[model samples]
Target: MTRMLLSVERDAIATAARRVMARCDELARMSSSTEGIERVYLSPEHARVNRLAAEWMREAGMSTRQDAAGNQIGRLEGAFGPEAPALMMGSHLDTVPDAGRFDGIVGVLMALEVVRMLRVPTADGSFRSPFPFALEVIAFSDEEGTRFGKALLGSSAVAGTWDAEWWNLTDEEGNTLREAFREFGLDPGRVGEAARRPEELVGYLEAHIEQGPQLDERGESLAVVSSIASARRFQLIVEGEARHAGGTPYDRRRDALLGASEAALAVERICSAEHHMVGTVGQLEAYPGAVNIVPGEAHLSLDLRGEFDGTRDAVWQLLTTEIDAIMGRRGLRWKAREIHAAPAVFCAPLLQDVVRAGILSTLPEGVDDPATIFSRAGHDGMAIGAITDVGMLFLRNPDGISHHPDESVSSGDVARGIQALAEAVLQLNADR
Candidate 1:
């Protein structure tokens, strides 16, 4: 059996993580969304973050460049020639409104660590070491899609699934995605060129915070993700007669708000029927929302997630069926729009095995045993897995809160994650 070649410096990893976390705070404050820190799509703040990432990549000895779609690529060449399949790793830089410090930044910075570790010279002035595959750290743009109501735009483009029609998608201010790209010094028409050939990539890996209570509850520093849950979203609009709240008798009035409430309740009931299924009414808007006016129309956004596609579809069907029945009986008009959907992703087993072995080997001798868990959240690794082999390692968050300012991970946990990642990468390239 080949021994793992783990040479990462503990101090170096910690310092790099702190540096990245600090940068995360800075970026968050700069992009504060209308909801709070809105670095949506090609916003000015998005451009600024991308430039900062490129500069950091260059400082770490990687040759960096931005693709037509504005996805930043930081390349670290291997001892082998360009023909060798490249080992790619990275996550998005964008975040939701009022997002926390870590979210996507941790994975990008950890990938940078791999480059930093390989570039440092040994005591004899020799290059540290080279792997068989070149490494590329990519900071994907617009993963949150908070601006255009579309998520995973950057990764979708790279995967050859970006729709050109969405280039004209405008924000609340009527600024088209293309216009924003131009303002940010990017060319929108060339997005398709960013699609990468599968042969060029051997595999991909991402290290991120658990963003949930799994690892924290389990007391594990590292979690090898086995799969990512699927997500489906629906938009429901209920229309009823407008009337004064006092003038319309409750028995005779067709209240859109009442219809919306019924639909929400139905969703909750459906989710309760299945294990691992979740349904949420994240956004609800009443037309002419007023203190004394009966709501004439109500719009609801339903977000559903589950471990399997069938479960997600079942929940969606249940909602639509209930909505139809309620609308017909209450004499209210209703319509449903399917917004976004992605199937559950099962990671490459080989890569996951490597990650598990690495964590088990490098963890402190007396620490708690590590656990492998399935991720309920979708990640860039989900898209990458569709194109090439992909694996993920999640660090334990103290409170399992992510995407908020309070999200945090302990320094020791971060260190363990770095060591495990380094070992995994080295093991993957042992023969080189």
Candidate 2:
């Protein structure tokens, strides 16, 4: 393992990390929102970043192209040829509203750095691949689903899981996905061409920020991702009678807002008790703006996740029972509509070992093993896992805050992550 993950110079690591940081700053300026970052799917910002990423990938000695689904792809052919199975690495470029600079952005840039470090110059003044398999770095265009309410659109296309129904999905501006595709200079009819066959990929490895506080709390800079959590999202509605707030007696009134609030609390309580389970009520709204009227309808969004599917579903069942009881006591009715669901994507054992070895290579003399974690946040791997084996490395984020402007990663961690991920790629080559 140590032989596979050869030591990288500290200066090289720092230089790669600085380039990544500077690129991140450049991308931050290409946002849709004036106040904070808001680059969404197929937007002008997305186009700009794709062009920029392609330029950087070219500088790293890879030929670049944009896929039919709008994903930016850069390919460095191996000794076998252009058709050879390739090791793929990348993450999404799209971000949630008011997003952090280092969520998915860092992964794409790190992959570019890895390619830069590995690409060899030939006598003909052309770049040559150092390994038997090619290296492909991708910048997925729509992993956040910020514009169209469907996450992983870019990765799903690459995984050959593109849904035709998604063509009708509309953005906030009422532009259909089909229209948006054409407007972005892509032919929707050709989107299927973007899908890659399983034989084309050796495997996929991604490096991303932790998006949580576990590594920080442990005083660690990086971790091996064991798995990504299974997630389910729902829009819950609570219905009750609308009546005069002042005239109705306490016992006679049915308050939907209060019932929904109680159910939200129940979600938190139940999930907290279950290991690796988490539930959040991120959105809530009550109908009837008048203060004098009892709220007849309340809507809330529930985001539930767990390490395993069974445990996550079981917790949801328990929450349903508890919510039923609460609504019964409040004389309100409740219903839930599942908005999105994804099964957990576990890292392949081979890739996990490689990533672990990579992390160990960057550790001090006395350290033996790297920390392992299950990601609570979703990633493009969840979609790409349908086609090929997937693995991930995680860098620490302070306080575990994500999807906000305050989301941050340290320069030292970024340097370490670049070395670790590059070493992981080399380790993979050796293992092969």
Candidate 3:
């Protein structure tokens, strides 16, 4: 059978996919959990994985280093030498608790593979990388925020947005982020050094799984992301008087838990009514809890996300109105504290065109168009957007799962990812 890719290119793509798969499995095994995969930022597992990734980067003909924020970085020079401006490619290395294998790690591995393919001969037997820009693979140390309750720490540092106050953020074990950095051999004071200048990068491209099922539902292997949703997170507290459950009748008692439950429902209703908006109450707790006690207070966490800031704020406005009404009706007091906010980011048009060409190259001529997904999930790109234009390609996740052990990606998609990435590099240089 005839192949669209040259024999060597096919071999490289296949080899790269297998290598990525192997590396993901290896890193998964290095997790902190005994039962499932759990590797937090700046932990022992984080250090070990950085070493492993650095080793792989070196093997693939790149100069590797760990940035001041503890992110693993590898730079591969192109036709020009080391100082040449580079196209930054990568995703985070951090994972949520009991995480799956492929969420962030796959992107980092795919980045390395792209560089490997660049170093080899093309169909025309070219010795040099087709692109004018060099390539850099970054395994960002913290995007999940499972430990510090703050995402994009590593990428933020690289973007020169490092929050000095984050050093005091603590974990479940009461270990401050500053202490964790010290334990991981990273100097907290030097984190500013991780920041990269705007002129140093050509742009950024990230390969990540479509955390939602759009690609799977559309029967496509990949999707080019158009935008990542803006997000706002809040801590909600509902206060009421505690009383003996047996003595407190439903009509007579002030139940904070019930009030909080209504607030959560209001969030869902308000957010769902808005186009492409999502609101989730991911955490909830009641104080002085007992089987028979009327809860005195309820605390819940809310995460609201939308395609645009105006639309998201509209939902928030409606939600707050509903919250006030709910509190007033329940004779309870409620408060909301904003904790995190990330604005929506649209991919650059030029980079999107390039990625579209890359996707087309992997498919048969005149085949169906690849899907375009609006990403509701967050990524390092949001942080990197501060420094340069950004684009992303999404691999299909059949189960539409994430942040759990069941998250997965197909080997075929991995191979296609390699091919598509190589084509993107060629297209960018060709356009220049």
Candidate 4:
């Protein structure tokens, strides 16, 4: 934790919610897809958003730059100047296909608003001249893994966990990440420059939508996150002979599609047997397109996540055992590859208290616990947690929808988020 000088007076911020919404809507149109939102890592849309965000950062009275990994970064130095550590803020800028306007975009805009509110000079009735620590906002380039099939790439670079092999990663268009980096005006060789030493940051705070129904169901506007879930993904291939539907006898047929179907059902069954865990077969495809032919092979993607790593891994073990049984009974050969694994990340207790205080400061009396939900979704914090403490404030989403066009957030909630986030920063700085 870091300490800062405390003061009483400050400039007021009134147009936060409107500004956040306007910025979000503006960024949504910068998407590469004309039909829907799709801003992948290092794409033309990525560059456009970074430029737009940098301009906004400048308007908010901060210095801005794009890191080697292409994350858009802005910093407001504290009284101690550039050598002083910072309290990191903001979230990823890239979005999923047909995405809504507010998912990651709102966090960035809210952060900028916080800066705008802070930038007012002492003549206008502001507090703590020169500040105590820098406020750094990072718009991580990719957290959705939409293009490279690997999430947290930009954050990992900053966390010093960049896997050297990722340079060769290819998108659906067969474009290698290295080539894309070059095209995006970044040098792959200098990516390590993006990493911040452990001491360079006081902590990382991310503001995002709940992405689930809990906050909405509770009728609350904001809540502190306890933890982000651990997740593991697998690519499975089930192989069986392709046989003509008319020629193959029912008893003799070894259908790969049937094996995949059973496997999917098994995932549902086993995951339901546990609490705080989910298994999803998001993609399922069978080979031999002709309707007359039995499937020669089937491919499926399995995403499993849980509140704890031990529990998630235990489920994985059980799933593998179940898959073996299914393959043995079906007379099909199967192979599986583990594509991604990220362990659970817990919010720091100190930061949680700070966030709770901020929430309580804004919410009316008789509100329930500030720490109301455990995030089952992954976030950029998972990577930043490698080097520093992390905390999160989740805004309400009425429909609990995300990664889709239907995603939404209320202006009132955004306003609360802005106030809470600013208060959290000030309180944390004053704590020590």
Highest TM-score against the true fold, candidate: 2
Residues 331-380 of candidate 1 have per-residue lDDT tens digits of 89998888888999988888888778668766656665568888888898
Write the number of the candidate with greater lDDT, choosing between 1 and 3.
3
Q: What is the lDDT of residue 27 in candidate 4?
A: 90
CA lDDT, candidate 1, residue 219: 71
What tens-digit string does per-residue lDDT give for candidate 3 at 166-257? Answer: 88999999999999999989898899999999989988999999899888888889888999999999999999989999987889889999
Off by over 4 Å in 4: 1-14, 120-130
Provide TM-scores for the models: 0.91, 0.98, 0.96, 0.94
In the range 37-151, model 4's lDDT, one tens digit per residue, is 9999999999999999999887777888999899999988787778888889989999888888887888888888777766535454432215677888899999888899899
**What would the TM-score be for candidate 2 when compared with the true structure?**
0.98
Best by lDDT: 2
lDDT of 3: 0.88
Report the Cα lDDT for residue 144, model 3: 92
TM-score of 3: 0.96
